[model samples]
Target: MVIRVRDLVKRYGNLTALDHLDLDVQAGEIFGLLGPNGSGKTTAIHCILSLLTFEQGTIDVFDCEMTPDAYELKQNIGVVMQNVAVFDELTVYDNIDYFCGLYISDKAKRKQLVQEAIDLVALNDFVKFYPKKLSGGLLRRLNIACGIAHQPRLIIMDEPTVAVDPQSRNNILEGIKKLNQAGATILYTSHYMEEVEQICSRIMILDKGRVIRTGTKEELKATISLGEKITIEVENLPSHILENIKTNPHIATFDYDDHVLVARFIRGENGLVDLLELMNSSHLQLGRVYSELPTLNDVFLELTGKELRD
Candidate 1:
C-alpha cells in the first residue's frame, strides 16, 4: 500500500472533522479523493502528511509509521497543494532548483533534475521569467515542477488544475499521467468531477468526513439505483402518455415540461425501446432524442445529498 489510515479521527472543538475514517491507496494507481468543501478531505491529507495532529488513529506511508520527524520518509513524498507555493523573487528555474535542492545535494544531478522538471512542465520558455511575470496557468505549471523536481516516489496533488484555462488543465492532466507512467503513485483530489473520471484509476467519495463509496467508476455507478437517462422533445405530450410513463415500472422517475420529456430509468431496465414504441404507436411527433449514461456526477449527487456544502 502507498498510504494507509485506520480509524482516523480529527475534531475541532465540538465539530468532528474526520469521524473514524479508514482509507487505503495502492501503488501505481491514480487514487482520487473526492469530497465537498469542509468534508475532511483537506484535514485527512494534513493528518497523513503529519502537518496536523489528530486526536486518534494512525497513518502509515510505504508500510512505515508517518511522523513529523520522519525526514527519510518525508524525503520520498512530494506534495503539490491547491495553492501555488513559490518564491516571488526567484525565476522559474531558480524556484524549481531551490525545491529540488532540499532533497538533492549533488550539484550536477540537481541541475539535470531541474532541467527535466522544466521540460516536464513545459516551462523552458518561462525559465527566466519571475513568478510575477507569468500567467496563472504558467504559474501553476511552475508549482507542479517545483514539487516533482526531486522525483519523489509518491505525489499528492490537491486541486492542481483549479482556476486554470482549458489548455493548461489538459497539459497538467497529461503531465500527471506521464508522471504515473514513470512510476510515481499519485493521490489526486479535485472538485472537477470530469477530471477525476478521466484520470483516476480508483476513486473514493467522502461526505461529512465519512467514506460514502469507494470503487472503480463502473463499480460505483453499478451500486447506484440510476441507469441511462433519455430525453425527448415532443410537442404537446398527451396527458395519457404522461400518465403511462409515470406508472411505468421501468422508469424510476420522469418529468415533462415545455414540450420536452425526460425519463430516468431504473438500473438493469431498458426503457428506451419501450418508450419509443409507445411514441410510435401513439403517432406523437418527436423532434429530438438523446440518451445519456449515468455519470460520476450523478453517482455523487445520489449518494451525497444535492444540498450545497460550504
Candidate 2:
C-alpha cells in the first residue's frame, strides 16, 4: 500500500474533525478523496502527512510509520496544496529552481530538473517573468511545477485545478496522467465530480470524518437506488400520464413541469422502452427525448444528503 490509516481520530476542543477514519491507497493508482466543506478531508490529509497530531490510530506510508521528522520518507513524497506557495520576488525559473534545490544540491543536476519542471508545466515562455505578471492559470502551473520538480514517488494534489481556466485545467489533468504513467502514485482531491470521474481509478467519499463509500465509479453507482434518468419534452404532460408513471413499479420517482417530463428508474429496470411504448400509444407529441445514465454526482448526492454544509 502507498498509504494506510486505521482508526484515525482527530478532535478540536469539542468538535471531532475525524472520527475513527480508516483509509487505504494502493500504488500505481489515482485515488480520489471527496467530501463536503467541513468533512474531515483536510484533517485526514494533515494527519497522514504528520503535520497535525491525532488522538488515536496509526498512519503508515510506504509500509512504515509516518512522523514529522521522517526526512527520508518525506523526501519521497511531494505535495501541491490548494493554496499557492511560491516566492513573489523570484521569476518563474528562479521559483522552480529554488524549490528543486531543497531536494537536490548538485548544480548541474538541479539545472536539468528545473528545466524539466518548466517544460512540464509549459512555462518556458514565462521563465523570466515575475509571478505578479503571470495570470492565475500560469501561476497555478508554476505552483505545480515547484511541487513536482523533484519528481517524488508519491504526489498529493488538493484542488490544483480550482479557479483556473478550461485550457489550463485540461493541461494540468493531462500532466497528472503523464506523471502517473511515469510511475508516480497520485492522491487527488477535488470538488469537481467530472474531473474525479475522468481521472480517478478508485474513489472514496468521506462524510463526518468517516468513510461513506469506497470503490470504482461503476461500483459506487451500482450501489445507489437510481438508474437511468429519462427525460421527455412535450407540449402538455397530462395528469393521467404522470400518475401512470408515478405508479409504475420500474420508476422510482417522477416529475413533470414546464412542459417536460422526467422519470427516474430503479436500478436494473428497462423503464425507457416501456415509457416510450406508453408515449407512442398515447400519441403524445414529443419534442425531445433523452436518457442519461446515473453519474458520479448522482451517487454522491444520494449517499451524502443534498443539505448545505458549512
Candidate 3:
C-alpha cells in the first residue's frame, strides 16, 4: 500500500472531525477522494501526511510508519494543494528548480529533473515567465510542475484543476494519467464528479469524517437502487401527467423542466420504453428522448441523501 490508515481519529475542540476513518491506497493507481464541503477530507489528508496532530490512529506510508520527521519517506511524496504555492519573485524555471533542489542536492541532477518536470507539464514556452505574468491555467501547470520536479513516486493532488479553463483541465488530467502510467501512484481529490469518473481507478466518498463508500465507478453505481434515467424533451407537461409519473411504483423519482421531463427508475428493464409509451398514451409530443445509465453523482446523492450541505 502506498498509504494506509487504521482507526484514524481527529477532533477539533468539541466536534469530532474524523470518526475512526480507515483508508488504504494501492500502488500505481489513481485513487479519488470525494466529499462535500466540510466533510473532513482536508483534515483526514492532513493527518495522513503527518502535518496535523491527531487524537488517535496509525498512518503508514511506503511500508513505514508516517511521522512529522520522516524526511526519507516525505522526500518521495509530492503534494499539489488547492491553493497555488509558488514564489512570485521566481520565474517558472526557477520555481521548479527551487522545489526540486529540496529533494536533490547535485546541481546536474537537479537541472535534469527540473527540465523533465517542465516538459511533463508542457511549460516550455512559459519557462522564463514570472508567475504573476502567466494566465490562471499556466500558473496551475507551473504549480504541478514544481510539485512533481523531484519525480516523486506518490503524488497527492488536491483540486489541481480548480478555477482553470477546460483546455488546461484536460491537459492536467492527461498529464496525471501519464504520470500514473509511468509508475507513480496518485491520490486525487476533486469537486468535479466527471473528472473523477473519467480517470480514477478507485474512488472513496466520505461524509461526516467517515467513509460512506469506496469502489470503482461501476461498483459505486451498482450500490444504489437507481438504475437508469430517461429524459424526454416535451413542452408544457400537464400537471395531471406529472402527478401520474410520481405515482409510478418502479420509478424512484422524476422531474420536469425546460422542455425536459426526466424520470429515474429503480432497476427496471425497458424503463425508457415504458416512459415513452406512457408519454404517447398521454398524447404528449416528444422532441428528444434519451436514456442514461446511473453516474457517480447519482450514487453520491443516494448515499448521502439529496439535501444541500452548507
Candidate 4:
C-alpha cells in the first residue's frame, strides 16, 4: 500500500471529527475520495500528513510510519490542496521552479523539471504570465505544475478542477492519467461525481468521517439497489400509464415532463423491455429510448441516505 490508515480518530473536546477512519491507497492507481462539504475528508488528509495532531491511530506512507519530522518521507510526497496556494508576484515558470527547487538542489535539474511540469499541464505558452494575469483555468494549471514539478512518487490533489472551464478540466484529467502512466500514484478528492467516475480507477466513498464503500466504479454501482434507468421521449403519456409505472414493483420512481418520460428501476433487468412493450401496446409514439447504468452519484445517494448530510 502506498498509504495506510488504521483506526484513525480525531476529536475536538466531545465532538468527533474522524471516528476510527480506515483507508488505504494502492500504488499506481487513481484513487478517489468522494464526500460532501465538511465530511472530514480534509481532516483525514491533514492527520495523515502530520499537519494536524490526532488523538489516536496510525498513518503509514510507503511502508514507513508518518511523522511530523519525517523530512525524507515528506520529500517523496506532493500535495496540491483545494485552496490555490501560489505567489501572485511570481510568473508561472518561476512558481514551478521555486517549488521544484525545494526537492532538487541542482540548478540544471530543477530547470529541466520545471519545464517538463509546464509542458505536462500544457502551460508552456503561459510560462511567463503571472498568476494575477492568468485566467482561472490557467492559474489552476500553474498550481498543478508547481505541486508536481518535484516529481514525487505520490501526489494528493484536493478539488484540483474546481471552477475550471470544460477544456481545462479535460486537460487536467488527461494530465493525471499521464502521471499515472509515468508511475506516480495519485490520491484525488472531489465532490463531482462525473469527474470521479471518469478518471478514477478505484473509488472510496466517505460520509460522517467513515469510509462507507470502496471499489471500482462498476463495483461501487453494484452496491446500490438501482440497476438501470431508462428514459423515453414521448409526446403524450396517459395518466393511467404514469400511475401504473409508479406502482410497478420493479420501478422505484419516475418523472414525466415536457414530452419526456423517465422511469427508474431498482433491481429489474427486464424493466426496460417491459416498459417498451407497454408503450408499444398503448400505441404511444416513442421518439427516443435510452437505458443508462447507475452512476457514482446514484450509488452515493443510495448508500449515504437521500438527505443532504453536508
* Top lDDT prediction, candidate number: 1
lDDT of 3 by residue, 1-310 (tens): 9999999999999899999999899999899988777777778878878889999999999989999999999999998878899999999999999999999999999999999889888999999999999999999999999998899999999889989999999999999998999899999987678899999999998888889899998889889898888888998888888887899888888888888988888964457777778788889888988889988778888898853132
For model 3, what is the alpha-carbon lDDT of residue 287?
Answer: 98
Q: What is the lDDT of candidate 3?
A: 0.88
Candidate 1 CA-lDDT value: 0.91
lDDT of 2 by residue, 24-107 (tens): 899999999877767887788889899899999999999999999988888889888788999999999999999888988899
After superposing candidate 4 on the true structure, give the runs of residues whose Cα lies further than 4 Å from its correct spot.
307-310
Task: Provide the clashing-pair count of each candidate structure.
Answer: 0, 0, 0, 0
Query: Residue 124 CA error for candidate 1 (Å)?
Result: 2.0
lDDT of 1 by residue, 58-161 (tens): 99999999999999998999999889999999999999999999999999999999999999999999999999999999999999999999999999998899
**Alpha-carbon shift of residue 41 in model 4 (angstroms):** 1.5
TM-score of each: 0.95, 0.95, 0.93, 0.94
- Tell me the spans in candidate 3 whose CA falls farther than 4 Å from its real position: 236-247, 281-283, 307-310
Query: Considering summed lDDT, which 10 consecutive residues are worst modelled in model 2?
Result: 301-310
Candidates 2 and 4 compared by TM-score, better number: 2
Instruction: Give the TM-score comparing model 4 with the true structure, all chains together.
Output: 0.94
lDDT of 2 at 228: 94
| Clash list (residue pairs), candidate 4 | none
